[model samples]
Target: MASERAAAAGVLRRPRLVIFDFDGVIADSETIALEELAAEMTARGAETSYEQARALFLGMSTARHMAYISEKSGRPCAPDFPDVWHGRLFSRYSTELVAVTGVHRTLNLLDRLGIDYCIASGGSVERIRFALDCLGLASRFEGRAFSAEMVARGKPAPDLFLHAAAARSTSPHECLVVEDAPSGVMAAVAAEMPCAAFLGGSHLDPIRTRHRETLIQAGATACVGDHAELQVMIEAR
Candidate 1:
């Protein structure tokens, strides 16, 4: 079909590796994340919504989130809030941050195809490990996961993804970044890596509206919502 050919053209001609973002892409944790953040914000008299939280807080570090909310609400978030919030969020995340739909199967497919891949996330190294361990995916990624905190700068900076690519021993141009946030897309662009934005979080529409062209203009060859379609694209490449 014409559509099939078009889809094929959208994929990389030959990719040496793939890198994935965590929070909204491979884990079903955004809704619960918003709830937790809202709870924390309520104590500070700030409002929250899945959309607002995703747009402003998700993919950001706790310190960044605290600073963001502080600026938004004009109130100082409790200094201990980060530790407490992290504890509460991790407890819930441990219980609820299951693998996203089809993620496990897709990872397996990639493994079967002998494709090199890694998780490049904005979360801390410990947090990334916790989620991977909870999902029993730790074994699949030995020396392959790199946290943003490990780099000089986080998302929108190109450090994390670039580090992951370096660990995989691949050129930036040959690596494909699978992301779910505008920041991640920006990071990919800054790294000069090809990217694909997967619309899966609460801010999906807004992120699409705001960054669809930015992503393409930033060097994303394609944007898609379905993981199956992404799998097909990768396989074709």
Candidate 2:
């Protein structure tokens, strides 16, 4: 295995693969997702911020989130929550879900460096691919992209990222996960992989400090603001 520096310097490394969370890490799907979700909840008189929505749904499968909410609220989530939420999200992001500010640049750098990577998202495969396509990242990933929908469980359970690592033919310790939600950080940690939390639109502050700590406690080596820090961490490794 080449050292981390070697890998970042464009040399092949045994830990060649990086698994990314799509909604908040790569594409700005979280913003779009929360926007639509908030609006839906608002129409139902349950308006909440992205932070609230994220707190409620991040790292959980959309279907599972709805179910949890239904169980907790003791009221059925709209029978149409899945299709409506999914449809609203996709419609709002019909052509706007883009890679984060530094994501494309980092991806280009990784591509130039010959580092292999994949998307391991909590989103369904169809939703993940839809956003990736909007950002023109679909073809770039091709067969490397995977979703929680492929696994028996989602984040905080390790199934999704574990599936991704298996597909990439890498060991958990050899992989680095870039995520934004607590559930994702937990997922990576549960898989025995290093992870970094990205805090962007989640607007978590006082809680973000605690959130970062929780991530570290759960298994993330660090928490950062964006992919730029991630690039630096990978290079420094």
Candidate 3:
């Protein structure tokens, strides 16, 4: 319905800059990452499922994810866990990662409109860059990627989003955040930015309804089912 309205209006409130979350919003890597995490935790004796892993760490940073796993599993994560996990994840990413469907088209729309855009994610900069490279999007986002490691706090806190806006020389209200996780929506809201919750990630296929409701409840101004709808929302004047 909102997509229809945006299409009819021919103009949504265009933002000065668009801030995207890297994993689920730009790259379809969340399912793979979560599946790996689930297996890792299960092997460590946590006995977690992919869904459970998603619910717990979908938008969390590496440190936070490890902490959550340690707490929930009642097992101390080995000091090298992050390194080991990242090694495995990156291996999978190299072979399986791809851009979210329609993302290139959405980016093209933004480029044609003269809108600036950047990425701000809960992932490490190395991982983010690696993913972009795997998806062949590294050049597009070359110097525009921001990671949680760049800020003292990550998602669900305004720090990272605010940092991204500041880095882009855009005011909070002038930025639009595209996110697929509730924590990310909350962070965008906390940063005083308009947020569009993305429901197009493959990881959301089985839990779209609940995820949509959760994102809305967390303060998303809009929920887009795909980058096509997102393009309409961004193109509306």
Candidate 4:
């Protein structure tokens, strides 16, 4: 680690690994997921908008989503909430999910740079795998994708990101996380990892300015709105 003076004096170490958050960063699925969640919540009498749902659960597990809904609505979510929500989600995903715009190009750039990357998401392993496979990204990640379920805690807590870095043979400080949510960015910060906050998700494009500031305030070292900006940051001197 370099002192602030040295860091400002052109001393720095390039990160050894890139950790990606999947739902919003890679799969182009967060908006759709939030839409479906809002619909489900409305149907179950919770009645929230997509915006509200996204704000409430951007970087949480399905269990947490349900808990939040229950607490907010003053009614218990159904015991089958997880199964039903996931069923609808996977159904829509089968027909609607796509890779985030420019993901392939960014990945190709990383490949050319010989930079190894992996997915570490608050999403469940099953959901992560399903979306990656749907987006034709499974082979690229192979054994490297990790889930919140694999760790003791999820985002805004460092456990999942820390576990991912450890499993991938990178120390926390040696990894750079590209995240779409404030919670994920905070988790990276807590893990002592440098963060490159991403804001290209369809759900976020509408609120880029606000989200960008929030991420920076949460300790992102860089904020990139799309893969092009990401490429620039990754290759910058």
* Residue runs of model 1 more than 4 Å from their true location after superposition: 1-11, 73-77, 200-219
Best TM-score among the predictions, by candidate number = 3
| lDDT leaderboard ranking | 3, 4, 1, 2
Residue 14 in candidate 3 has what lDDT? 83
Q: Give the per-residue lDDT digits (tens) of candidate 1, residues 1-237.
A: 337334634656557788988877787666776678778876676777666776676566666777777876888877887666667779987777777777877788788887788889877787778778888888888788888778888888888888888888998998888887677888988999888776655435455556555555555667766577677777777
What's the lDDT for all of these models? 0.75, 0.74, 0.87, 0.83
For residues 173-194, write the lDDT of model 4, one tens digit per residue.
7888999888998999899988
Question: What's the distance in Å from true for residue 217, model 4?
Answer: 1.6
Q: Which number leads on lDDT?
A: 3
lDDT of 1: 0.75
RMSD of each: 3.1, 4.9, 2.2, 4.0
The digit string of per-residue lDDT tens for model 3 on 121-231 reads 999988898899899899999889999999998999999999988988999999989999989999998998888888989989999889888988998887789899888
